[model samples]
Target: MKKNLLIIPSIIFTFVLLTFFYLLVIERNPSELPSNLLNKDIPIFEAENLIKNKKFISTNEFGNEIILVNFFATWCKPCRDEHSYIKQFNNNGIRVIGINYKDDPKKTIQWLEKLGNPYSDIPIDKHGRIAIDWGVYGIPETFLVNSKGIIKFRHVGPMSKKVFKKINLLIKEIK
Candidate 1:
């Protein structure tokens, strides 16, 4: 009985070790949060435009071409960090809309002016209701939408150079 018990614990230990090794070998980001809104139509939202004198209607703005929606705030360092990649998307002819999440409009405008505005429309989410509707948990979250207004991918947190390349590939893959 003692020998059998020893063998059982040894087997369990080996199994656990192998499991950890397998997880380590996998090409995955442990920090990445899977977006629940993937492959779903973007949530309908309407908000006042920061620059324009009118409200931004989701129905009219989207569904014609590829759109990139970025939840950003002037206070978020990561938002600042990913500004260049966001601009790159805009430069590639993608219509990018920025949801200014709970940020001061004046500060956001100043920041955009300093960093170079990449967004076609800056929607004011003064109370973060729009972000909540879109299932946003963090600042600097980026979503790629197709011509049909369906969200294809969501990247949470600051986008790294690797993520920039990965998103670029996805942009090409989309029609």
Candidate 2:
């Protein structure tokens, strides 16, 4: 009985150590966005406008303008951090569309009100299916789609001054 008890504890210890090692070393990082879809056509998505609620907007609605599709949630702090940059994009003639991922409408509206809504059209993705179709693993991802509706670049976190500069250059190049 004593030997069995010791063996069980040893097995548990080994399992714990292996689990930690796998998590730290073998597991892939979550922040890395897949590059396979770059330069590909943007995914088709039609969602209810979060602001208006009654209207639906899709990829085809933006026409030939440079579209910035931002996947965010009201609870995401990084999304809030990038709101000003989105506003800047809007001011610079880029059409910014918001995809409110898996959030309550009331909270989303409240968050937008507090952050100052910069999205030309805010779409509600209450089930997050649209985000999944776009290969989004996390919140606050921004995709830059060209006038032809091809995805040119994807910004995977809160945009910084440097990132915005880079994005602007890409936008110009795509145009």
Candidate 3:
């Protein structure tokens, strides 16, 4: 009876060791956080347009297509780091709407000009209220919202090549 009990404990320990090894060997980015608003309707708000000189209304903008909304700022290095990937979406005929989070309009305009403007509509979130509504805690956050204005996927940090490919795949699946 004691031998059987010892065998059972040994088996359990071996299983736990294998589980830890499996987890350690898996490919995953630790920095990415899942969005709280997945499959939920986008947060509604009206903000000034940085370029259009008009009220940028959420209801008026969304619900027509599979759009990628980027919450970014000129000051954030990650935002700058991810600019090319963001532009790639535009290059592939995706409409990217940018929410300029708590950034100066002049700096934003200049930055876009230098980086090559990829955004279709640039809305000024002079205060980060829009970001808060979208559950954004960091700059360079990207959200993919479907035609019905439901947020499908969100990436929290700088866009990597791997991440870009993943987003493209997700976009196709949702569409």
User: Highest lDDT, which number?
Assistant: 1
Candidate 3: tens digits of C-alpha lDDT, residues 1-103: 9999999989999999999889789986666678889999999999888888688899998999999999989999999999999999999999999999999
Ranking by lDDT: 1, 3, 2
- Compare the candidates by TM-score and give the number of the best one: 3
**Candidate 3: residue 97 lDDT (0-100):** 97
Q: List the residue pairs that clash in candidate 3.
A: none
Candidate 2 residue lDDT tens string, 1-114: 999989998999999999888888875655575756798888777888877756664655655878898998878989888889989998897888888889998988888788
Per-candidate TM-score against the hidden true structure:
0.89, 0.78, 0.91
Model 1: colliding residue pairs:
none
Pitting candidate 2 against candidate 3, the one with the higher lDDT is: 3
Off by over 4 Å in 2: 1-31
RMSD (CA, angstroms), candidate 2: 8.4
The stretch of ten residues in a row with the least summed lDDT in candidate 2 is: 54-63
Q: Which stretches of candidate 3 lie over 4 Å from their true place?
A: none
Write down the lDDT of every candidate, Cα atoms only. 0.92, 0.83, 0.91
